[model samples]
Target: MARVPQARRQFAAKDRQQARLCAEQRPRAPPKTALGVWGKAAPTPAARRVQDARAHAANCNRSTVVLKRRGFPMMAPGQVDLLKKRGKKLGEGHFSTAVVTRWHGADAVLKAPRQKPNVGQFVKECGLLHTLEGAGGAPEPLGLCLYPLAQVISFAGPQTLAGYLEESRSSAELLRLAADLCGKVSEVHEKGIIHNDLKFDNVIVDGRGQIHLIDFGNANPQGQTFCLVSKGQRCPWLGPEVFSQHLSSPAQDAFSVGFMLDTISKLMP
Candidate 1:
């Protein structure tokens, strides 16, 4: 063979090295199996139904027995109705109104749908609260009522972070509150859920200065994709990606936390 130039040989060697590196770095396809590309068989229709039923039963049992064991009993529909008539209105949101009341002699908030169409959202919020039962910084969900479409949850506090921020707060206090909020967000994420709404109004500060996250109506399971429709106003706490891709993730909550911290810093006097 004719003698190859030294530069040509060097170039050929570099090309081979680059090709090998690229091959090594390329993502490998998941191993395929007889059932599916995920290497596991898909559940049959009957099996899927059974799985769903089991999950539903588990949630129902948890909400009833476990909550009762934790000193929060399932209130009867009549009792819930009575509370609605007697309880003091704590606050009102677009979908629901919170009424502060007593449940089994303990402070509780009865959240009822403002309209018939909002019942589904109320139920979802109750479910999310139940899922976060015993979680630090989350209000305990007592139970749900169907007659008037409401849910009773432990009273987090009388003051929201929004109102609390109006008062003069020492730097240490603000830092402590911010830390509590971030810690609460992490706890929610650890439970495999994302608090999509992390604004000041959704956070409650107890008399002891401990922060608790409330208003889980906008929350969704982590990694779920969801579109948030505005109710004639823009949400400042939500990450910009939520508007574009409409995906749910822990990063969204992180962005909200950053916004909160920035706001707190600005308010610091």
Candidate 2:
């Protein structure tokens, strides 16, 4: 081994001293799994029942057991108008009002169906958003509110990759963002879930440059009406068999990501 310089030797000695101090001063975290990942705390008895209720509560007319069991923080009705609407009316196309809203001093996009809201779709969307909580790119669904006529999901962020691509940017940054999006979508599909309405507008981006997939009104569980709509840019994101009403798979999500990358590239100046 080469002899250490005096300055270098002093730095290593200080590092060791700091490590020892930290080990003594810091509180220990809960034990991690064999793979060094933190293990999730087991749900309480009440929480378990809530999970079951959410799973079975297909429609908005959920049973009392569901309402009571699901301990979701209830936002008072009529609080919807309190949110400050921001940004340009980002080109709404769905059967809902897709306006961006600001809540709790943060940027969160809101989606509330205009026609009679689809309850099954609401449940699936909540499930997917909640499931992929911290995987990245995907926006966090702050809360899902059920109404008599319509339901709303609050997501954190603004405009999707499509909106970003509309302006000039570096190709490398675009590709990296696209790749990160693909990885998150793969995580979604791996959970045996499918986001039926996958498109640019549905993918929201925040100020920190993160991608969040939104719009769950068209989402469906494994054995539901797998209605496929191939409109506008949706066609490129969807697979060929998607036109035939075939159910979505993980590969379909990858294809959608690939198309999104292509679309982003074309818009770059």
Candidate 3:
């Protein structure tokens, strides 16, 4: 009985250590997890089978970007202002609306939180993205900002991972996407940010096969602990630790990446 708790702690510690190493570009083998936390009832990803662009678009869970003017515009620091609202709603979750808007003279997405609590959540995510971006060679996509209007992030190309899977693709292509996603989660963990939410819908791939990870509203900084009494936010990507009401940690992020990789791997024939 004592060894069980001790072993779990050891695994978690190693996960956190791996996260730090990966964030810093120290090459290491990825974590190979046992079925310690995943259960049979956990959500499994479905195979996407569409083969053409038209078919992919039709099959993807997408919303046309709605272009409408807000009565009041949103403004970010650095003189960024909404010049135009672009398209229909790109995506919407329980906490935010992901929409395209012209900001600082470029097209950007407004990941606007829907409520007060969500605002704080978005703010924290923005901070993490900025920090990791700086550490990761100042990547442009990480330049997310909390505008009085919304949390503005760079707009990824059309097609979520699910949609990308639908397009006719090679086995090599599938492996690249999975590997890239694994790298992304590790990169964030290196910075001590736990992405509480990781799913196919949040990952976008362009027509050219470029990958983008978006939406960090549920992320938390290192060492901050939150009680698991809430029910509405749990998703299928989460691990058993989360289901058991433990605090979110870097290990959970690893578990998510593990499942994400497994899910994407099966997309190949």
TM-score for each candidate, following the candidate numbering: 0.70, 0.61, 0.60
Instruction: For residue 14, give model 2's deviation from the true position in Å.
Output: 99
Count of backbone clashes for each model?
A: 0, 2, 5
Clashing pairs in 1: none
Better of 2 and 3 by TM-score: 2
lDDT of 3: 0.60
Q: List the residue pairs that clash in candidate 2.
A: 137-211, 139-212
Runs in model 3 deviating more than 4 A are 1-87, 116-118, 134-149, 227-234, 243-247
Model 2 Cα shift for residue 109 (angstroms): 3.3
Worst ten in a row by lDDT for model 2? 82-91
| Residue-by-residue lDDT tens digits, candidate 1, 1-269 | 45668778999999999999999999998656358556587777898999999987776666566546655446677988789887998989877888999888898998887766464566567777778874658888787755456788898789989899999999999988888888888888999888887888888888999888888888888888876677565677888776655768898889898998999999776
Error of 3 at 257 (Å): 1.9
Local error of candidate 1 at 169, Å? 1.5
Model 2, global lDDT: 0.62
Which structure among the candidates has the greatest TM-score? 1
Tens-digit lDDT track of model 3 for 114-222: 6653444554565566667733111233233333435566665657877777777788888887777777677777887776767778777766666666666666776
Give the number of colliding residue pairs in candidate 2. 2
